[model samples]
Target: MTQISINGVQRQVDADPDTPLLWVLRDELQLTGTKYGCGAGLCGACTVHIDGQATRSCLTPVSAVGARKVTTIEAVDQGQSARVGQAVQAAWVKLDVAQCGYCQSGQIMSAVTLLSRNRKPTDADIDAAMGGNICRCATYVRIRAAIHEAAKALA
Candidate 1:
């Protein structure tokens, strides 16, 4: 058994030390909000905060987490950067950004992180920061627009 603090609570999960945190979070803990895209970490769908940094959970082993703070979208919505997320979510609803809605969570996660770090991110910054996330529906235009809208509100 290994102990990991998810969001804020400490929980012990019985699994391989090499098991990816993504599996531990979704399978054992049943936090399905984090999605699996490319298991290799190319996609940002599994992005979560590890010790306050956005990390790709798909490539991170549970054993490596140690005492780091892990925050997902569920808890990120209430985090210090939550207002940015709320603004982004609102903009998403207003712009109808989600095509299939599968990638929106990851997109929102990345956006919240970006907005948290860069209060006024430029188009290049948004592109560079959000480049890892893939939206199969090709909703990039609306996504960018929504980010701009959300940034306006957040700023």
Candidate 2:
């Protein structure tokens, strides 16, 4: 059994060590906010935070996350990333960023992590952090603009 803290709650997950965390969150905890994109860790769709660092939940195992904070988008926007999500969501609304909205969760997760790390990120910095996140609707321009707008809001 692997012990994990998810969204401030502690739970013991009994599963294979190699079982992907995405399944654990969705199946066991029923937190569906964290999506499953590529399942290969290439896409950022399964992004979640482990100890405040953005990590791909699809490629991560339950055993690997022992005794660490596993925050999904459900809690992210509600607890820790509320203000950040607000700023980003406001910018997203202003910029009309969502098209299909399938990938927005991952995009927002990456953006929030970036904003948390660098309060003021240049275009290149944003690009570097957001490069792996693929938006099928191709909302890169609006996403970038929203990040800048969120930074402005933070400032």
Candidate 3:
């Protein structure tokens, strides 16, 4: 059993070291908030924060996680990211950002990471930070607006 810290808790996950963290989170740990998009990491649906930096869980081997704390969408509003997470969620809701709602979790995760770092990201900065997360519903405009609103709330 390999011990992994997730959402501020330490738990031993019984799985192959080579198993992707995405499967570990979804299958082993049942933390299904992190969706499995393109397993090649092209799509960011499996995005999660590893030690405060957004990481692609689908491409990340469980063994590589080590001591990093993994924060999924399920607990994004609990720890260090609580304020930012709340703001992002509120902005997403107020802006009606989700259409299909399949990719919103990853989008929100990336947005939280961007806001946590920059706090005043411009369009270019938001684009640069969120480029990896893909929203298939073509909600790019609302996504950008929601990001801005979340930033304002955080400010």
Of the candidates shown, which would achieve the greatest lDDT relative to the real structure?
A: 3
- Give candidate 3's root-mean-square deviation (CA, Å): 0.6
TM-score of each: 0.94, 0.93, 0.98
Arrange candidates by TM-score, highest first: which order?
A: 3, 1, 2
**Whole-model Cα lDDT per candidate?**
0.87, 0.88, 0.94
**Per-residue lDDT for 60-81 in model 3, tens only?**
9999999989999999898999
lDDT of 3 at 11: 91
Better of 2 and 3 by TM-score: 3
lDDT of 2 at 112: 88
Write down the worst ten-residue block by lDDT for model 2.
Answer: 76-85
* Ranking of predictions according to lDDT: 3, 2, 1
What digit string (tens of lDDT, one per residue) describes model 1 on residues 40-89?
98878898888667789999999999988888878876666668768878
lDDT, model 1: 0.87
Candidate 3 local Cα displacement, residue 11, angstroms: 0.6
Model 2 scores what on Cα lDDT?
Answer: 0.88
